[model samples]
Target: KDFKSEEEKREYMLYLDGSNSWILKPLNFIYNLNDKAFFLNSDHTFEDAGTTIEIIRRAFENSKNIRKSDVNSKAILIKEFVDEKNAKKIKEEKEKYLKLSAKFSCNDLHLELKNEDCQKFSKDSIMQLIMIYAQYKTYGKFNSVYEAVDMREYEFGRTECVRPLSVEAVDFVKLLDKFEDKQEIQDALEIANNEHKNRIKSAKKAQGVDRHLFGLKQMIQKADDKTKKDALEFFNSMGYEKLSQNFISTTCTGTLDFIGYLLFTPVVWEGLGVTYLKTNDEVIYLISYHEKQKENAKNFAKYLNEGVEKFKKIYS
Candidate 1:
């Protein structure tokens, strides 16, 4: 991949910039010679995390097969050898435990909840705990909460938003805050779980409210002048602004064994982004946030851990 000269490299770079053929193969290979590492970068516009991970796994598998064939061949094949000494030094320099206050931090907390616990309580039960923590952090008010729902069942479909904040969720959180009655709390939790399930179902069917409103806004851009004026006025209203602010953005990235961790910045400056995976024996969360935001990712993780313990006690 090396060019003949500096001028040739410059020309090749310009050619890539001007060519549209790169869109057909949108994967980037990054290598760190000092650390002896290889990284594959996939653009989010073309692939979601799930698809990207699958692609990477297949690519690695193919490479392993090729290496196996080379082992049996008598012909010599050029290979890049790893610098073990330098790689070990680089690995040692990287911190094992990172503080959440660092810019664009990520924290992965593995909980004690098992697959049996997941079966005993719905996923909504876990989400209810998250909502309670959000309320605690926001001083007893439920902010706009979002969860991404994959809509790839339809042709050319992408994702839809599932707003998790609801009247039932608010009631459940409030009851847990004030009362300790087991039956009352269980009933409220069940109601909230049902409401959440319904919302998720609606989103999966592409009947969610957010995307519909978004589509309307897009259409308004090409509407007649009078219609565009009214649509713009409505979309620009204060109520719409409040509704659009997602204070807690969350998504469950499924239980793919190859996925070690996932992270994304908060949607809004003061918001929190949470991507989680539930394994057979534990739940892992990768919480992300801005350092200067009012909310602290570490504190939120602590609250969520406590909430998990409380949930375990309730079901125990």
Candidate 2:
């Protein structure tokens, strides 16, 4: 403990650096909660600062279900479902809502998968596709879906302007229940894979419609009345009822490989964040969710494993 006084740390925070809420959720914690085996221990050294920044940027950038606004400029704000939810809480109700929502946050589960079992679907496809399918089967509903994309190949003003590789992966998930024929199944997979590939391409080319609208939304929020109303109307048409549950939910941590020297268990603020990682022979599935409110992290993890197993029976 080198710090002799609390004032020293306060100086560093008050003047040296300060962050707003926009960057709060992904500030990157170096320690664990109650000595939990969640964080990537810096005890094992690395050549670059790859693990932290890349994982953080990829998750946040790629998780948007972008919708466009009426504005001509790239400054049009994209309204999300959460933005439309009429959370009209009074003073006392606000306190209660906070307490209730807090209870459902900060949770995770650890599981493993066989690489061979995931062969046909590939690691990314099988994990996302199966998870969405399970949610549909379990909830029997439609909602928005988002996934993170790595946009390192393209250039942005920043180090790497990456975003999520998002698509309506749920559409493919629905196909699983719709058809049993071999041809139908093959066709669905092709469509799903094609959607996945296209999303990556769109994001890399800076044609990410969602975030572009989100940026517009940001500007309009501070703009005059005439522009804001039209922007709000565009979002109103989309409706907010489907937001009660996110399809793919939050894109916290995607895939990580620290030369086989990293341990990752990402925490999700919405629905769930699937952290796909691996060791020598085991593929680790770390599902992070809020506390058990409705369907939780554990059941999602269970359903996903079961969903994959059923697929294996047919394909393998």
Candidate 3:
């Protein structure tokens, strides 16, 4: 309900102070009709001091909601005066509070209408100022304004921080070996073919080309020298050689890390040697960077050790 007058406002203030619903308590004491103001007028309650009958009586006269019958039940809650002018100041401050709240609301709507660009958001705008003012008003503690701003900022920060996952080095080899099993190899090949076909279809539809070779080439060009060197080293470590000419390299999308996975496929096969090579029969390792999937690497290594222990599998 709207605070219509000074007494109504005072009642609301008392209500806020006495209630524990808000994060911070607002009032410290309750006064009755007749009491000498003590300790900023908040040192004693009506129960502790019997002399508050007059003050309560005046408050009741000014308040419309204070029924003659309920006066005995609801005594006035009092708080320490930050200053004698505080009640009047708070009364006046309500005007500014309402204005700020309204402006903040408008700002929220405007920001939503505008393009979603953090850099473009006005630094001194009402929305930004409202958040800052709210923080200052609450002194870093809980308040309605502060809580609202915190939630908005938290969501924006989370969106900005989110990124796609990327594969790591150790599992690169294990994925290849996993495909060595006939059934697993067949399933992996099907998945790879599906992906390849989808990509080819997308590329052809978009650019009228069966092979998006130009796009892959652009990715190879965009790669930093360090990334290229690291990629070559990774490939060599897996017994794969760099293509004499990076033919399909010019066309690619997505992050360099994802592209690196695609690029690493040939290297894995090459590193294993010419004996494993087949014409037009490419292999794609089903690699995941999921932390949980890494347990499979340990299991695979254990299986390799067991096989060697049983058959004494010789190294080349």
| RMSD to truth, every model | 11.1, 14.9, 30.5
- Give one digit per residue, the lDDT tens place, for model 3 in 1-316: 3444533333333223322322223224333233322111222222211123334446546786766776676645756556657756765666564443232100000112112221232211212222222222223221111000101123322111100011211122233333345444334333433443443344333432212333444466569998867655644452222222211111111222211111111112111100011012221111111223234323422332332222111111
Using TM-score, rank the candidates from best to worst: 1, 2, 3
Q: Which scores better on TM-score, 1 or 3?
A: 1
Give the Cα-based TM-score of candidate 2 against the true structure.
0.57
What is the descending lDDT order? 1, 2, 3
- Local accuracy of candidate 1 as per-residue lDDT tens digits, 232-270: 998999877776778878777776555545555677767
- lDDT of the structure predicted as candidate 2: 0.48
Candidate 2: segments with Cα more than 4 A from true spot: 1-122, 152-168, 239-247, 250-256, 259-270, 278-283, 292-295
Q: Which candidate is the best by lDDT?
A: 1
Model 3 segments more than 4 A misplaced: 1-174, 207-316
lDDT for model 1:
0.65
- Residue pairs clashing in model 1 are none
Task: Return the top candidate by TM-score.
Answer: 1
- Return whichever of 2 and 3 wins on TM-score: 2
> Model 3 residue 217 lDDT?
41
